[model samples]
Target: MAQGEKGGRASRVRIWVGLFAVAGGALLVGDPAQRGETALELVGRWWPWTLLALAGLNLLRSAVPVGSLIGPLALGAVGVVGLVAVHGLQAHLVRDQLAPALLVATGAALVLSSDRMGLRTSWTRLLATGDVVVPPSVRCPVTLRAVLGELRADLGEVRGQVEVNVTAIAGHVRLTVPRASTVQVNAQGALLTRLPTRPSEFTRQPHSEGEFTIHVLGVCGAVSIARV
Candidate 1:
């Protein structure tokens, strides 16, 4: 077979493999009782499986050259799984609900491993008022934070380092920047809306030679910034 054909075949196999991984992980971790519930209830009860499925689909679709929607969906799903698992683990010691926990762990792995949901050479932003939007690319250095709203990011290039700190009761935030930019953030409470902002720093200076924009949305909270 020609090189292009060989590559295409390999890509197809990879997509199938990714799909199988997701489905298998979901099945392995999911509870049959929870699966029988309504879709809304099922998601509320067993979000790990939901996240796993979406993450898998996102991974499979990424190889086929598609639009931008799946990328964000995968990111959001993984974020939910991470938040739930971390919070659950921290809140409970015995882990009475092992099934949910395992499902979440499996989904988290799928989300983290998928390239389509990972950060790329594009500007990134987050908006949150009640639901926190966690980017697969953005790794939280610290653990334990309360989220209430939404987070959003626009496509742009990022230069240098940006830092953010949010403490709000309810609201949303948006961020946009150039590609190759680095950002650090500390947040607590809920996020509600969507918008873009520049990266900020706390005690350091930016090293890049370009300017980046930062925006924060707060309902009844505070945001601090510095250069790094």
Candidate 2:
């Protein structure tokens, strides 16, 4: 698309993210008696599915007038198989194996549906095994998708106003950038979405050059951004 359109879309994403943050903050400050359930229970349920929420965003990455059906189909298949294998039957697709299986299945679905999903290898990064590299020389906007995967993006070479969008459904995404990189963690989840005010937490926001903007959405996963 054109530069202005891309900028507009990016701004819209930021607006939605800001709205989500504001709503979450309001929920915390609002009354407990009227909210029905206790805050603790609400948090507990949300914590586990935090990163999984990224799947919703993924499905929308390349949408159309009708809608993006790949996400629901793929995830539904995974859910059905997982449910049947784990809970429906006595199948052992649970515990430790579940995460890996989901990752593999997710990757497969995306690749298989690449034709319709607008999944061009050029602008998107998919990691199924080891680290994911963000070309140090290229300064284009990109999306990173990792399932049962590990992402190590080197953004120290990025210049200009570039957007780095990340969606991790069931794995860890680590970003290595200059110390001056600005990190905005608008991750949607139930609890502890922001890096706690601790030095050990790597997802914490860092100083920025105001050029590289990072938008990370994780579900049932984690993202750590640190200096290169």
Candidate 3:
């Protein structure tokens, strides 16, 4: 297929995926009883919403190329609506459902836009010395020491060598890197690692070349690395 056609198909896929995410979120918040469940439980049950939101956001940001303010505003709106619907109403209503659904839908739309516009990775390195939640697709290296808090890495091309450390606390770490990147993950926590199904020549081992380094220090949670 032509590059444009392939791109179009990817765009459509993002849209449909976003729609499904919205629908799934609607189901979770549609029932107030779901709120009775613990936050962890709810998150576990509706984890897909979070993934959908991330993918949608990533995609949307790329497509529209909007200012930074708009992204935060949209995220805040989704959080508010999700929280209100899940906590405010005692009785279930379509409106309650709509809030979460829209949140997911908006996320989906954002994802579609982002993918089309080709904005996939952030150049900034985020360090959170507390409980940090990360996506499933991240690549982690095993060279740095451990610390207290959570660390997450959204994968991209690695131009150099990297080291990550996880300190003596329980937290989460996520890494996303290009397939050509080398990764070493050394952790005491029960790690949940995610990688692309297809094998690539990039991340087969540690590299001697020095390009970029990603390091994480934390206690416990979950660690995920998605190879680009």
After superposition, the stretches of candidate 1 with alpha carbons farther than 4 Å from their true spots are: 1-100, 112-209, 215-223
lDDT of each: 0.40, 0.53, 0.45
- TM per candidate comes to 0.26, 0.38, 0.28
**What's the lDDT for candidate 1?**
0.40
The best candidate in terms of TM-score? 2
| lDDT tens per residue, model 3, 52-114 | 655455445434443553666678667766776778844355355546765565544443333
RMSD of 2: 14.6
Candidate 3 deviant stretches above 4 angstroms:
1-151, 167-170, 188-218
Ranking by TM-score: 2, 3, 1
The 10 consecutive residues of candidate 2 with the worst lDDT sum are 115-124
- Candidate 1 vs candidate 2: which has greater lDDT? 2
Which candidate number has the best lDDT? 2
TM for candidate 2 is 0.38
- Tens-digit lDDT track for model 1 on 179-220? 334444422232442222432352223554333333343455
- Per-residue lDDT tens digits for candidate 2, residues 1-228, read 445545655786798799978876787675746553665665686655644544543444424311254556568667867787666754555544556545654555555343311222222334333333455555356666666555456667665566767766666666677666555554444132333233232333454553555566666666777765
Model 3 accuracy (lDDT, Cα): 0.45
lDDT of 1 at 80: 57
